[model samples]
Target: MKKLLKYSAFGLGGLVGLMLIVVAIVAATFNPNDYKQQIIDLVQAKKSRTLKLDGDIKLAFWPKIGANLGKVSLSEHKGSAEFAAVDSVKVSLALLPLLKKELIVDTVYVDGVRANIVKYKDGTTNFDDLLSKDEEESQTIKFDIDGVNVTNSAANYSDEGTGAKYSISKLNLKSGHVALAEPIDLETDFTVTANQPAVAANAKLKGNFLVDPATKHFVAKGLDASIKGDLLGGKDVDITASGDIDAKPDTKEFLINSLKLAATGQFSGAKLTIDLSAPELKALKDEVTSKEAKVSLVQEKGSDTFKANLVLADIKGSPKALQSSGITGDISGVQGKRTISGKFSSPFIGNLENLIFDLPKLAGNLDIKDPALPNGGVKGNFNLTLHADAKQELVDSKFDLKVDSTQLNGDVAVASFTKPNIKFNLNADTLDLNKLLGTSSAANPAEKTAANQKPADLSALKNLLLDGKIKIGNLIYQKYRLSGLNVGIKADGTKLALTGLNVKLDDSQIKGNLAISQFAKPLYTFDIDIDRLDVDRYVTANTGATPAATKTSDKPLDLSALKALNADGSLRIGSLKYGKTKASNIRIDLKADGQKLSLNPLAAKVDDSQINASIGISRFSDPIYSFNVNIDKLDADKYITKSDPNSKSPAAKSTGDTPIDLSALKKLNASGEAKIGWLKLANVKTENVSIGLKAADGIATVSPFSANLYQGNMS
Candidate 1:
């Protein structure tokens, strides 16, 4: 038996030596580069594609079976356009592993690889012919790779059907020990761009990963990723995330532990930051759960800042339904001297299959502060019930809110996200604009003119559809106090109507309806009636002496907007008082039709006098005005300002030819006629007065100025 064993050992040794010699001979004599043309021809004949090998091919067989390829490219199917290219590649396999039917690979290096893939409208890809269609199942081959390093690789993909393009460039990947079902360290950096929505981003990822193709299981540990990009309509953003993840889609199970994500961005010059965290999250086909989750956000722009923080605990859900123990949050906003802070809490539940979500009871408290506000702002408490259905595109919310001494309750409902229709009903115990906005005197004519110079932008109202009602027990604005105010608002397309507007101010009762159409070139129609209104009550009295003018009042009026106006309205006041003048049953009918405006019937009764007037303005720019006036009896002194005799310093008495600035009238072309049955001026009395005025182009003349006085005729 010893002799037989020695012979077998000798034979085995000789066989090994022979194999080594043969391998050496083959390495010395064989030239892989010589077969390059043959390989290219074979590929062309089989796949109908060009194969270009720009660099020599190399091979090794001693320590390991390996190959080195440089600068190789393949053409598109049947076309010369390049589909894929590689600058260099090196790969080797341990020969001894083959004895045990085990394959082990050394570190593989690939550099400067590029590919272009395209899917045509017919759902065929450019590389379809290159892909092998194997119908028979193959035995699983277990293998291990020492590592892989890839650099400067790129890929481009385009979908003709959708007209979408995506590309990844400057890609680098490094990995440590890759094997099926075993953890492998991986790191990658790449830049991706997409043309569909126009997004570009640079991203980096590092993690220990495990994947099993057979079981479709994936796990990632110590996963850290970062991305910076211009996205979301060209906003610059940076995002970072870290977590441990396990997923088994075949079994419908997922887990994420210690997940954290942070993002920073800029939008319209505003800086925004968001942070989110979850301790543990788990999911299955039938169940999903999370430990505790938190999210925080902050936005800042100039002097304005906003912050919010939210927390959720014990989140549990299923594919069809979900629930949370509670959600708690706080929000704060600051703008200059104004600040608003609030806290809220609610239990949430949802039916995801139906796309419906509900918050049964949401309660919150708000605190506000502003130096300009009366009492330095206010505090409030609120409660709400909210419901949303994405499938139906509907949202209905009911809320009750209280601030200071005021109470407001409302229900708002919106339907159809596209071309939305909104309906709301709001009722308030009191709304004090005086406190919210601060009381102020009426604006002077100059201020009003300045305000009118500002352009109005109503484009957003062009597609609005709204129906709402508001009822307030009491309302205050500036010096105007109102009670029992009820307003109904309706809007569709570019037309809006304010109906059922009824309010009471002091001793006056007012009702009005206003409608607007064609928001771009708005047309207004209104009808308003008031039982009594004392204009003097709201106007601040000028008790001091008038100051001398420091500048000439020759500024031309900007009445272009009024000349473009299209309006028809009527105003009626049962009793109106201006300064010391009192009028009753005053009615004015106004019409503005692009080129002309007319107050055809202006009638009023003052004490024992009855007056009727008609005024027309044909040219608003350098206005041309025409008027006709008739009065049965008038006391002119009642319309004049009276001096305060008790004052230490009264207005200076006017001497002859007191300077009257007629520059305003120079541009106001006018023709007017007035007749009064009886008139009184200062201490003079006249039984009949007739006057005619003609002013045009900086010229003025009073013609037919006649009156019956002192038992004689005066002209």
Candidate 2:
């Protein structure tokens, strides 16, 4: 028609130029290392398994597309599978028209892939049963992405029920896939290494994965994580956190739905938020170590409630009982969800060897609830009032707690508990007894130089702080001491009760009542009552004595009591006016057992002697006697042969009785028995010339023995 349209366009341009030279001679023999062994035999024939390649399997792509096996081996049944680094894999064929699949994966660049995921301890797995079954269904595929890199991956974990094994080494990850032909999108980066060190350094974690191909259900966003280390012993921590997670699509057992958490960020940022619908898990994160929980925690075993607003910054892989320890803020009431509240705002700095004690920089608001965990949980309760300051190791106390509660039942050890706990009201107030005797100054400074030096080597025995204040009533820390100590002083073993047990070196005050019923057969009881509140600076710092006057015993003395409450000795308070001696109106009703003291008939008008006594103080020469005295009246020859003389009685030993000096009878034993009644009779006292002598310091005058003298035996 126009020469047949120019020979039909030159015979179709010579048949399209001979079909582009026969496709450039089949793309020039198409040999790019034979298409990289046809992509390693098409990924070993769709993973029929077996694939090993170390370099040389490359196809720089441009016509050869992509292929770089580099270092590879994919067996997977549980072991023998190493990609060790692929970094380049871009196979191609499907360019998407409508939906076609010639097995195309336009991109796959893996880097340093060293994956070792095991599951033994009996769970058995080396990837057991390696991926199978995929009857072809690429609802449209033609990927396009180039990103994959992982390094130093190590993950080891075992769990033969409870033997538990752990390991997770340096891992750095990066994954990618999203050239979106649809249905395959991924991007990940994970780096976590603990115990294997590096600990992510002050750490910052990120996690967010979404999957909902209709309902595979997995929508995690802003995932959070936190960690710090060494807190209990104190020092160095910068913790942080962030959160949001989900898992619950019908349960394969990954039930943790939507949560929110937060934490500051100046080194380690921190935050924690938990959701409930929980049925179980929390022994820190129950994978189960078994103390036999969940019956509600074992049927209301008690204690667990806590309110928090924490500030944990220096946190890192803890669990050596919380390495060094940590506790910061928010507590109004807490009983059992376990809240030991510390880092020390006031547990009286509870000497854990007192490094510096911290943790209670609290912001109040706490609650505890325990007693509901025999199986279903919620049986933990505890309430605590907060206010703590005082540290030299710790003192300056104030604790007020009410308890129809007690539950730290991860089964005990917080100082030991066997259950059966109750304290309707517990109150520990202002106790700075020199930091419980550790030489307080808030201790610290190495416990103030080890409470003032002295520890080159001493095994065991470290707790010692005889401070004060303890007004308990039921008393039962091993038995006894209920009614005896009036209500305090449990003694060296501790129950303590002091109105003012001062000790600033001198100004001491102590009213007595000390008891111990059992500390391995211990029964030291006392009803001691002393005055002169500061008795000559406590007898010049205990027994250097030397005070007969200075109006010093520091006043407060006014003795007039005699009621041993009944163990014998019913009534005998006839003037015990001490200091300047005044045994005066002495009346006695005694019943002493063992060394014997039977003053069943004792009446006295001392010094002027209208005394009637009967005392027997045997042995040691025998004459500390105050046994018979019916002194109806006595001058005792000017009171024992002119008063004053060692009362000279050592002469008679022709087996007749009279030869004292047991240090003159252990220095006249005194109201504490050794001798003393009948107004002292040593030189002579039968009533003045009628004789009356009180041996040198003990006084004893009995000449011709006063006619009123009754029944006696002295020594």
Candidate 3:
């Protein structure tokens, strides 16, 4: 028995030695380089491309059954440019595994591989022929690869039609146990450049993947990726993401499970950071559905910080259909520690080509700081609701804000944008108009003129309507303090009306209504009533110009504004104080049309005397004015005497004659009549006086100008 075992062992050893000798003989005799021409000829006949092997090809035995190829290249069809090239490639197989028909490869190592692919406008690529397969060929062979490692590889693709170029460089890839139907582990790092969108980036990916070769279904687990690049027009961005992905190529359905991504970038000199996570997301073609997602963003620049959080759910469809799909989300943010929260939705989404917003409903609460206030800040809390229907061309919004000692409520609606039917109501406890104006005084003439200049192309006001009401408890405008101010206004295309405007000033109350028509050539009509007005005070407060005693210029006054104006207005004052003059129950009616203007029946009571006057002006360039005056019981001595009763009258002194320019009279055409019941001046008393005056073409005449002096009539 021992001898028989020994002979069997020797036979086994001899068999092993014969196998090694055979392997050695095959390795030494086989010239892989000699087959290079055959491989080139076979590839050329099959792929219609030229193949070149510039370096040696060698085979190895004993430890592993392997082959190493050096410097191989394939040329573009009918072109001298190389389509793909490789510096070296080494493939190894376990001899025992091969003997067992398992065909286990130790490693497939590919180094310095490069490919330049181009797609032309004719829908043909440089590698099209190489990638095409004959229909008659049967795919009956199947094999498994234990591992593959690729290093220092690059691929470039260019589309001639789109002028787009993309390249991947310094690519390194590693895969383990790749099979037709089994799971595989993969890791890759590459640098990419894209010309169409203009991006440059370095990316790394690590994942475990299961792929079904038949149905082309793929599932990825524990996938992580990172990219660093300059994106979005040269902004430096770094992003990292991890997720599980599943895809079915047949159904075109893809899903991501537990996706978490974080990014940091700089945009427009502001640092931005974003964090996003989703439990599950699914998509098919243009339709996308996602579960609740948590998203956070923070932006900071200098001392300003803004942070926001968003939770989204049930998101589906393309951007255009998203409006109709009705998205629901909660958004909250803090700007410098000012918290704001809102529920956002879009029930009826419309196409962006014709709509302002896909989902325009926003209802939010804000606790914010108002930096425009005088204090450190005006702390305010407000509830705002806004809604818009771009299809209907309407907007409706309302807000109620309360800050410190002030509260405001406003509701506004715009029925249409094209033909703008608008309505608004506003109420405020107190508002400092000066504060809102923010130190901006009245603009200079140049700015005002620029602002008032008519547009080169005017759009017609068609079907315009507006009705608004505003009320404020107190308003501080300029240097004037006012209270209980209310304004009601209505406007249409052709006319605008201010129905009720009331305000309380200092110790007086003002009430007025105004109407304007003929927008093309505006005409104004107003009726204003004031309990008492201090003209000097208002003039001093509003304008720096004060009344000065100076010689009147002979140059004609520029009444172009009046000539351009078309207006009819009436003003009434219970009492008015202008400088040292006091008047009561003053009423004036004014009218102007083109170059003609009339102030008829201007009546006032001054110092217990009643005065009535009528004035007319024509020819605006060099205006001619006609006036008729009537007075009853005027105490002239009071006005003519000096303020100091003890002061003596100075002796008369000769003064140069101030010649009056009658050039304006040439443009005048005026006629008037006047009468006085009683008049007293310097101890002279006159009663029952009448006068008639006419001026035209530089001629002036007074006819039947008579007065009863000391009870005697004189003419």
Candidate 4:
């Protein structure tokens, strides 16, 4: 037994020695060029067209023992061309013996590789038609890579049909050890591509990967990168970046850690770099939408947390994802509301710092710090802030839009702005008067000579005038669209109180109040009084009323040619002027329910020959007027023969054949009432010196309404 055991041991030793020599020869006799054929044969075995290998290789104990490579890249595409590049890669134990309708690769190590796969414009790829039946049939690959690294590798993918494109750049996955029993378990880099406009970036990742062998699930940590870019056409921007992310596929979610960015460059032209960890991009977006998002320094332990400013809203990017949007604005002492989502964004401005939110369709509240939205060619709503001087004077201003497309309620259309807290409310169910005002402008007379009678852009009218507190300007009404209507606005002292001011777009003028607030007591109202106002120039724009071969007047005043279709005819109340007396608080009221009007009593100044009418015809918008008072007892001789017959009557009065000396009334003493109708001035007499009278357009008429005997001959 001893002898037999000894012989067995010697024989075993001889066999082992022979095996060792063979392995030694195989391990040391490998030719570098032979690797090409070896890889080709292996790839061919799997029916693959292109086989690329790189990185150092190691073999131990000869061909029968084991062979290993540092790192290698394995890629596949379907086309005539091919693409290849490599970094550290390794593989051991070819496992040729394990081939039987299967390929079981053993011992692999890969690190730091860069590769690019491109789909050219001609509907072809870097590797087209490069797959064989066996490779095509292989449903999965198993990898046990100890170390792998990829950096700054980029690839482009384009569609053959629509010419759409996708790309990845600056991709890097380093210092990671992973195993992929299935394809999806493969750990890779995140990057940004030019083709994906909506997706600005996805970059930064590296570390260990424990992927589910069959389920293709993966978990990642310490993945981070920088992001930067503009979103809207120079109106919106996202430029600063840094963050870290961790992804766990089995849990179907990701987490964001240590993410931060700053605002520099044109927000429209912004750039960003980041070091953060997030499970998925969705989680990062949600973080941005938070009312108060916090981000820490990626590399520092004592970094300040930054909070986002100017919270707009964090609704989904699409319209259907949100039901409504709103905003807020405040200045000196005024405030108002409007629907931002349903109307236009041009009328107002909004303000936000470090963020340019140009919302063409964005809806919200709007309030420019400027007392009023600065007037100009600026389009749409934006962020704006305005400043006022110590003396309550307008100073610097920023015109940012706060709201977009805001719908309005029916009763209120627009508000006119002249001073802070002094916005005039205008109402027009069928037509907005302010909108029309905004659309009308008057060209300079030098630009509108006989050679250039055409109207210039009428919309700039408001821009042509001083914008501030009222300064007693002329209020002319002309060619009113409304029919048979009269309106007036009056003010007393520094206070303005509108009365009987109205507008009926298709017909006549309406009546309203013109009370303005006082400076010392902003809460208190004031009313103003106007002596005379031109009725024609206040209504129509871009128009004129020139006479055609004028004719002299022959008949007495008739006074009855005005009617209101939509608005009631009422005079804006003002003080009544008569002989030796002036009545204050004179106002005309037109009742809507009954459409009736009441005129303020009058104050008259009477004379013997002719009665001087102290009334003003402030009714009607056309070139017509009516303001004639009657004289009960007047001497016709004295009435017709005065130096100046109340010189205020050329266009407003109609004097009959028994011309009265209205010019003398300024020096005479008399008394009587001035009859006033809808738009008519009538009957004036002082003493009985009968002298019938008339005025332009018959706005003034006197019945036997004349002066007593005085003129040489009676009519």
lDDT order of candidates, top first: 1, 3, 4, 2
Q: Which stretches of candidate 1 lie over 4 Å from their true place?
A: 1-284, 291-293, 301-304, 334-339, 369-378, 433-449, 452-455, 477-479, 543-566, 593-596, 618-621, 637-665, 677-690, 703-715
lDDT of 4 by residue, 543-649 (tens): 55433234434433322222221122234333333433343433442321112112323333323212334332323232222333544333334334344555675
lDDT per residue (tens digit) for residues 1-715 in model 2: 9999999999999998897687667556666555556666776676555566656654433333445555655665423455223333434433333245333454444444454555666777555555456768746544444544554445554445545444444555544454433222233334343332223333344565566554565645555555444332222333444344454444322324333332222222222222222222222221311111111101111243333333322222211112223333333334434333322121212212122233332223223233332222222233333221222222222233322232211111011122212112232222222211222123334444312111122111122123333332222221112211222222233322233322222221224444333333222334433322322322323344443222333222221111111123334333444333344555555553223336656775655646666564422222233444455554444433232344444232133354433333224422222222333345443222233334434443344333333453332
Clashes of 2: 165
| Location of the lowest summed lDDT over 10 successive residues in candidate 4 | 406-415
Query: Which number leads on lDDT?
Result: 1
lDDT of 1 by residue, 1-715 (tens): 9989999999999999999999999999999998888999999999999999999889999889999998999999989999999999999998988778778999999999999999999999998887679988876676889999999999999999999999999999999998878889999999999987777999999999988897899999999999899876547899999999998876767799999999998888999999999889887778878898999999999989999999987878884788998889999999888899999999999875567899999999998888777898888899999999988999999999988878899999999998899999999989877665544555656556433422345656877999999999998776668899998999988789999999999889999999988677677899999999988787767765555535545644546567567788999999988865788999999998768889979999988899899999876666778999999998888778676666555244554457765776666578999999999999799977999999887788899899999799899
Instruction: Give lDDT for model 1.
Output: 0.88
Candidate 4 runs further than 4 Å off: 1-16, 30-82, 85-128, 135-143, 151-154, 165-173, 180-220, 228-369, 373-715
Q: Which model is ahead, 1 or 2, in terms of TM-score?
A: 1
Residue 583 in candidate 1, Cα distance off native in Å: 0.9
- Give the Cα lDDT of each candidate: 0.88, 0.37, 0.77, 0.37
lDDT pick, better of 2 and 3: 3
Candidates in order: C-alpha RMSD to true structure = 10.0, 24.6, 17.5, 22.9
Per-candidate TM equals: 0.61, 0.24, 0.48, 0.34
The parts of candidate 2 lying over 4 Å away from their true place are: 1-30, 33-64, 68-90, 93-177, 180-191, 194-257, 260-715
Scanning candidate 1 in windows of ten residues, the lowest lDDT window is: 449-458
Query: Which residue runs does candidate 3 get wrong by more than 4 Å?
Result: 1-373, 376-381, 390-394, 402-405, 440-463, 541-552, 641-671, 695-700
